[model samples]
Target: MDMRETPGVTPPHPAPDVFGHVGYQLKRAHAALRAAMDQALRAHGLTVPQYSCLEVLAARPGMSNADLARATFVSRQSMNVVLRGLQDAGLLTRPATVETGRARPATLTGEGRRRLRAAQEAVYAIEARLVRAVHEDRLPALLADLDRMARALSD
Candidate 1:
């Protein structure tokens, strides 16, 4: 059934206002993506942040906890918690104490890479589903726009 034809159906805001705003829609999309990621990673016994930490560590081994926090866009304290969880799970490892500096460099164990590989399959599938929602020709532009938006907000 068409939403427009339903009785008592109305947008929360006018067409040109909040309901149609880009930032509002983006937030909604982000929420949906986060939920999807959480569900996908759950089967691997990992949270989204844990999966994120694993992914970054896979790409750049020996990253400090602070570096992982920045790459994952979480606070240092939060990253420390994630790291401790991963360590306890035997997925990743860090020194008992910082050898050179205050930062402890983290690296994935063989099990970490194995789990990350499995999780990547599921996460990449979700990403592909989202990409398929848009026109093929617009994918590059859409990605570029997202990058630009992040850069703009960061700056």
Candidate 2:
């Protein structure tokens, strides 16, 4: 049987162009958010990756460099540079030598925590601005949908 002949059915619309594509919109949104985050973090002497590493380390201390890279959505090499800068600034610490394997766990120092807290206030304000753009009743649902989308893509 032809599916087009089925009752009470309609065909989906084709994507109009780049402007109409959901992927394009998502990319645009990511770029905008990244820019906002970068600007906000800069005031605290932090880049986005640096802030991300500090944030994650605060939450889950002693994570390996590779794990931090994955959590921050950056290449391992890129994360190494971020880690080096943070380490140089005395914002974070790792063992001088790995005790066992090549993976040296990292942790935020007291200074790192202080900087992360300051950065969080700025970042949260930026996030609040975005949340306020959506209706109050729909905000939770919108956040959930975003989480779902991220999970889907990551998997």
Per-residue lDDT tens digits for candidate 2, residues 21-51, read 6678789988999999999888899999999
lDDT of 2: 0.89
Which candidate has the highest lDDT of all? 1
- Residue-level lDDT tens digits of model 1 in 119-142: 999999999999999999999999
After superposition, candidate 2 runs with Cα above 4 Å error? 1-15
Model 1 C-alpha lDDT versus the unseen true structure: 0.92
Candidate 1's C-alpha runs over 4 A off are 1-15
Give the TM-scores of the predictions, in the order they appear: 0.88, 0.86
**Number of the predicted model whose TM-score against the real structure is largest:** 1
lDDT of 1 at 111: 97
lDDT of each: 0.92, 0.89
